[model samples]
Target: MTSTPSLPDPAGAGQPIVLPANGTTVAAEDLQARFVHAADANADMTIDASQVENVGQAMLQLLVAARAHAQAEGLHFAINAPSEAFLARVAACRLGEPLGLEMEKEREQ
Candidate 1:
């Protein structure tokens, strides 16, 4: 339903940050807000995309914005495994390059 879902504490660790449900335009703003909130709170943040059900440009934007926001906040940012179903779209979006290799490496861990 929403890309960002609802506000929750990243708290550095405890739960895998998830981008649940289908990503849509309406969810982008919330996603950005959550990312900023995360950056503000966590010294480092891990985004788990293993539960990402669907994705779109909005989703891409969310990740990109989150990366930038987290970086600006001086927080380490990483993404868990992204679903294979949307990997192609993620690549095509041309935002993956900016997402860094962290997601891949994290997936391996």
Candidate 2:
């Protein structure tokens, strides 16, 4: 017997989706749907990366795209309370500025 992973309901604007520990290609589709829903709502979109321990290019790309969509729509988008692993991964990919990781670090100071 096989079971399909359940799709998550779209989180309301300003509400964050706490990312799972694995932010890999397998998770990109679900994440994309959530971002699309948030964009369609025409409100702020926030993602909590506090639980992200392992991340991949697909996830990072998805986040960048989501942020761009929010910006183009004149809505706020933020990634809150990111874990060290998440931070390092963004930096390693040279996406700190685009992903707002650099700004987030400054805010913590």
lDDT of 2 by residue, 18-104 (tens): 788998797987777887877766757788999999989999999999888888888878899999898888877778888766645
C-alpha lDDT of candidate 2 relative to the true structure: 0.80
Clashing pairs for model 2 are none
Give TM-scores for every candidate, taking all chains together and pairing residue i with residue i. Answer: 0.69, 0.81
lDDT of 1 at 67: 78
RMSD of every candidate to native, in Å, equals 7.7, 6.0
Superposing every Cα of model 2 onto the true structure, what RMSD results?
Answer: 6.0
- What number of clashing residue pairs does each candidate have, in the order they appear? 0, 0
Clashing pairs in 1: none
Model 1, span 44-104: residue lDDT tens: 6687777666776877777887778777777777777877645655655555667764234
